[model samples]
Target: MAPIKNGRLLFNEVPTGYPIPGRTTVYDGSGTIDVESEPLNGSILVKTLVLSVDPYLRGKMRAPEAKSYNPPFALGEPLYSHGVGKVVRSEHANFKPGDYVYGSLLYAEYFVPKDVSYLQVLVRPEPSLPWSVYIGAAGMPGQTAYYGWKAYSKAKAGETVFVSTAAGPVGSMVVQLAKQDGCKVIASAGSDEKVKFAKEIGADVAFNYKTTNTEEVLAKEGPIDIYWDNVGGSTLDAVLGNVAPFARIIICGYISQYNGEEPYGIKNMRQVLTNRVAINGVLVFDHHARYEEEFYKVVPKKLATGEFKYSEDITRGLDKGGEAILEVQKGTNTAKKVIVVAND
Candidate 1:
């Protein structure tokens, strides 16, 4: 077997604030893998197809000594995240050649995972959507939205719901789900295009948070009964001021604070007390057992039939890996940001 070229995005340095592209994470394209001969040893050899670049990966880019929910990225190894791939070879009985799988895969052209527990065989729908959806709308982000809404939002008909970063994977799903539940959904996005997309997907009202005043929007459309928060900063503080009594707040991500040196301090603590708001943070990994099967059954079918709409911002090739993560971190991405490493 001849050595085929392999490129990987390596965690080069720990960033003090926003990560610098070749300095913080370096793309090394000089490596090679002999696909036919690479040792599997109860592992699966995956020829990476597409990688999911997410905001959460930014939090894991810290120094190894730092303690967090997920471990820090190794200084010189390939960065890993949710991805869809084709199995080239397998030593494990559960997976075999040509199986398309999705899970925590490396940001490289090829990978042989030391652990296979995180990987699962992808369930392709009857009328197929793009494989990227598995990592975007129908994967981790989708499940996060589904489980959080089911477990925490406690939304009822005609209740006003506000979702921050509402054009994003998780936020967009929350908007659509809330609408389907007969809730009046107000969505906020970083750009006008995203705001438009949010409205297109069933938001009763959608606004550009960057240009529109968050406090004013919430004041008009809320007494918010449910708030699905993605960007946790001033927007969250403004939400505190406008929440209905007994409002349920789901803290999905603090994307605004991930790249910052310090966390944003919310000044409206009294609002929480006065409103009797119940705040809970959702980490999707924690609730997968409760929601994974149901999500796969429902969301994928809706997506295929156009009962639900999803937007993905895909950057072609592994070479764009560094820029893809940067797009997600900076909120430059209009929707779910996915890097397509190869065609299936």
Candidate 2:
């Protein structure tokens, strides 16, 4: 095994506002990964590679009193997120020294997780696909779209499904999944390039919401049966206004309001009652039990058969992790923005 060291992204103090500048402290491998070298009888030591920088992570950076779910990133401590890595050492009976794994970890090169019950060990490494896909298509975003489609929206063939943030990891998958179900998919992206990518991924209609008014475009597009909302705010309000009766609005995320000081309000929620629409907020972790069964069972099969497609925008280093995360929120990334911790 390679020599273990301490490497991490650290913050001095939590930010109180937006456009956070160079507050991150980057530590190259230099210290012990854990206080104890031996796993607590059932733990594994993973060497992290790719780390995910998601929009929701911004919420975690705020003061704990500000929100729920995940707590604030501790001042002067290593930040953490979902990452793909290899098991360099293991004491757990289920894992071996050379096995590959993917799970939550501190933003460090090596992670000694005492409780790896939640971590998944990769059985087959596919050379055809990049390891980063485990963070996208075969990872959280994929599961988000998959379970969101099957459980909440229950998208049907010949229906018109509208998706916001259509070029993102989850949004792109929703677009392709809806298309494969024989639904006419309309997607809204933040830029022309993202719109083009959405169309390339099989969205029947793709529009840049930054240029065209969402309400105006949806008005011309007519009523939609399903609304897969990733960017809430005005886009969701517009979608609510144009939704068909018995439509399903999947509340995947609210990226637009993530950075705002004041909460953005939606003015058209009455449509939920008037149109008998069903709106559901989804968290991918809620469906962890069926993750492998669903991804490997359905999504991969479709991808292999050319029925689904996905794209990623990878940042080369952990030093750029914060920048990559900010870029996604700013809609600067055309696809899933991931930070590659190690190439090999």
Candidate 3:
């Protein structure tokens, strides 16, 4: 068999703003993997299938020494993050060709993992849910949404929960999950179309935040008992003022502030004090001890019963990864951004 032709996107220069195309990162058009060569007992080579292009990746595109939950993407090296791939060659005892897997892998057509620490064999494949979904709503994002809200919000039946970015992969799932939990849901989106989409997915009331006054809307919606925030700029400020006493605020992501040189300062943080709000910032990795147990026990059941539905905004090639990242950061992608790097 011929060695595989490997193509991958490498982090190039750091971007001070929206990562400029081909400037911050560039796709290495072609390279190779010696499929004919011997492999270590634990090594597995995978052909990339689907990759998730998420906003959090933006924060990671910094100098290698920069501090964060994830180490920075080393310059001129292959970019890596949550993606789904299929094992084509394996020396690993547990993996075999035709097995679909998910992990923190490079955005490459083909590659070998440095170790198995970050990869997991997919127990279930797609068609029931597209294989790409392992990188979308049913994947990391879904787990993040489910765990984040459940862990912090303490949502009870008859209470109301408000979520921002309600049409996004994680936020969209939050709407349905909260409703399924018997919590009344109020959701907000950037556009009118997204507003309707949020409702179609289960938001009790969905509003276009761009045109509406958030403070007024929340006031009319009544005192929100929990805020499942996906964006943490002015909306966080507004919700601060309208929340009920002892309301829970789950900090999921601040997409609104991710690209900003200067953050939108919250004017109502004082409310966090006086309103007795419980604000907790959640990073998915922080809760990995419970990942396998929580994810398999929850998402699979919801998925099987037709109770879970999500959308993906796909970019169709390994080379298009850069464009997909920009689409997500700029809030232009219509749904969850998953890059289709290869056929499953």
The prediction achieving the highest lDDT against the true structure is 1
Greater TM-score among 1 and 3 belongs to 1
Among these predictions, the greatest TM-score belongs to 1
Q: Which order, best to worst by TM-score?
A: 1, 3, 2
**How well does each candidate superpose onto the true structure, as a TM-score?**
0.98, 0.91, 0.94
Report the Cα lDDT for residue 311, model 2: 82
Pairs clashing in candidate 3?
A: none
lDDT of 1 by residue, 83-188 (tens): 9999999999999899998889999999999889989998676348988998888888988999999999998999999999999999999999999999999999
Error of 2 at 93 (Å): 1.6
Clashes of each: 0, 2, 0
Off by over 4 Å in 3: 38-42, 125-127
* lDDT on C-alpha atoms for all candidate structures: 0.91, 0.79, 0.84
The lDDT of model 3 is 0.84
Off by over 4 Å in 1: none
Worst 10 residues of 3 by lDDT: 33-42
